[model samples]
Target: MDLQLTNKTAFITGSTSGIGFAIAKALLTEGAVVIINGRSQKNIDSAVKQLQAFVPNGKVSGIAVDFKDPSAMDAVKQKIDQLDILINNVGIYASKSFDKTTTNEWHEMFEVNLMSSVKLSKYFLPKMKANNWGRIIFISSECAQLVPEDLIAYSATKAAIQALSRGLAQTTKGSNVSVNTLAPGSTLTESAQEYIKNQAIIEHRSEEDVADDFFKKVRTSSLLQRFTQPKEIADMAVFLASPLSSATNGAVIKVDGGSIPGIV
Candidate 1:
């Protein structure tokens, strides 16, 4: 399983923590030259240091660019003319009732989750086409289909991602380049773990009990009956980034532990 990714360069957004960082680590393990991104210089530096410790001899770099700011991405564009792989992983979400969600919140969700990918692909996809080879992975979510009532805005953004991914994949028709989306379900990142712990305290129940109740009452359709680990999702992304996944263009691959419940 060489992955055939040695020396290939990759750029991932929001790589300072969580799923982004996990993907960066996996890519590095496969010998890819990885450039991580974050919103602040301090965070970027910290992530770079952490990654350097793990991939001592591997090439790792970082850039501070907030995708929400138009000007910030210009700086990012200047640093790299072309990329072998681009992972549009940066996103923001707010969980509130539709009546409580404001217009600004909707705009912010679309801006960061949807528009950022559109802009990045516009700039880099042509270069990929010219070279006749590249990989573009959009980190979508199971929410696109699940569409939780409290997460309408977030679900809308995720649905837009799937549509955009398919449209972009069409452009790569005869080329070696490929564009696809990876939709992951409830992954227990540090933040999620903290939230669950807080729920346990508030509900006067054990953490395991809280989790079990969640699967039974909230996510009853889930066959796995538990949260997925970040590394599990990262492994799928690593494979998608590699040359080994040549035929998977224009597809939505799910690492959602059977929570999505639909066969296609």
Candidate 2:
């Protein structure tokens, strides 16, 4: 389980917390150099401090840039030249009826969710190709296939990412560079934990009861029948980012606890 990732440089977007942060920690555990990104220096510094506590001597750094800004990638380029692994994990969503989702909302989701990966890949994929070794992982979601009514815009962006990832992998052909997507199910991140806690208080029920209702009523197809932990998703992401996963290119690997039914 060495992952052979020592000294590998990884950059994860939106990694100040949640699954992105978990991925950064996992990579650091494998002895990889990680540069985490967030919108502000305060968040990045906090996350880096927490990561160093977990991985003691881990090499970690941060880049604070808002991917929503068109000029954000330019700032990133100035900070780092190349990467052995690039994880497009930053995303935002609004849970609302499709009709109520405005044009600006749709544009914003696409810009943050899909275009961020597009921009990052456009810049780094060639560098990886030239170096003849790299891994690009797009953090997609099960919503892409489930297409829940409340998350149509978000789901659309995730679906687009799958196509984008596969096409990018095709360009790698015979190179050591690989492009792949991971579709995770409802994971219990910090935000999700707060949501459960809030719902429990509102419903006058225990947090456990609220979580049970989420699986039974909201995500009825989940075989796991509970919220997945961020670490679960991060474990798979770190593996995919490693040189050990060289043969897994162009695949939409699911760590969705069987919420996505049927064999592919």
Candidate 3:
């Protein structure tokens, strides 16, 4: 089915790999012009090349500016003058005890995860409202509701981002612009695989055993009993970024494999 997204432009932050890259691929496949972001030129080039190889004739470009830098958005604005979709996907996470997490880490989490969305939304939401059409998706996590002990700061920032998305959606009342949050469960990204490998080696367990332990013990609420693939989450994001999802605004849709228990 056509998503009716031909020629529409989208900018996805932190799109060098994992879920972000997956979203870029999905959007490009749907015939959207996609601009990807990463911290370094090498990463941006690599991701763009991979995306082009995956979707020949797809219009794709890249921006290499570390989101941690205060002037990063300025550089981004210079490259992208406008957009039909703005996905705030750049995020940083630190898994450690709350007490062990440094104050600097907390600040960094808020800066990259929450503040980046704030700034981007501030810039694009107005343009969207003026044009009378746009899509803004915040890539939240199930941890926002689960609030795992080791991911206190990350969880807090995710929850705050959802709130921010809802508030921004409210501003788009009576318009075609929509802002929503997509909450995902733990997915097997390259970094996550490395972490799993390290844990398996440290505990003298097989890789499969380590992943099983994660769902069985740590993520007991996960009904799927496995990792949610990056593409799985990307599918939802691509829809939300399209004109088809016009009715879904100010909502928190979960692609969390039932890890977030609720009826709402």
Top lDDT prediction, candidate number? 2
Q: Candidate 1 vs. truth: CA RMSD?
A: 1.0
* Cα lDDT tens digits for candidate 1, 177-248: 999999998888878899899999999999999888888998887888999998998999999999999989
Ordered from best to worst TM-score, the candidate numbers read 2, 3, 1
Return the TM-score for each candidate structure: 0.97, 0.99, 0.99
RMSD of each: 1.0, 0.7, 0.7
lDDT of 2 by residue, 66-128 (tens): 988878989999998989999999989999999999999999999999999999999999999
The alpha-carbon deviation from the true structure for residue 38 of candidate 3, after best TM-score superposition, in angstroms, is 0.6
| lDDT minimum window of 10 residues, candidate 3 | 64-73
lDDT of 2: 0.95
- The alpha-carbon lDDT assigned to residue 58 of candidate 1 equals 77
- Residue 177, model 2, lDDT: 93
Count of backbone collisions within predicted model 3: 0
Worst 10 residues of 1 by lDDT: 67-76
Candidate 3 lDDT over 1-264, as tens digits, reads 889999999999999998999999999999999999999999999999999999999999999988888778899788887899999999999989999999999999999999888888888889989999999999999999999999999999999999999999899999999999999999999889999999999999999999999998999999899999999999999999999998999999999999999896
Of the pair 1 and 2, which is ahead by TM-score?
Answer: 2
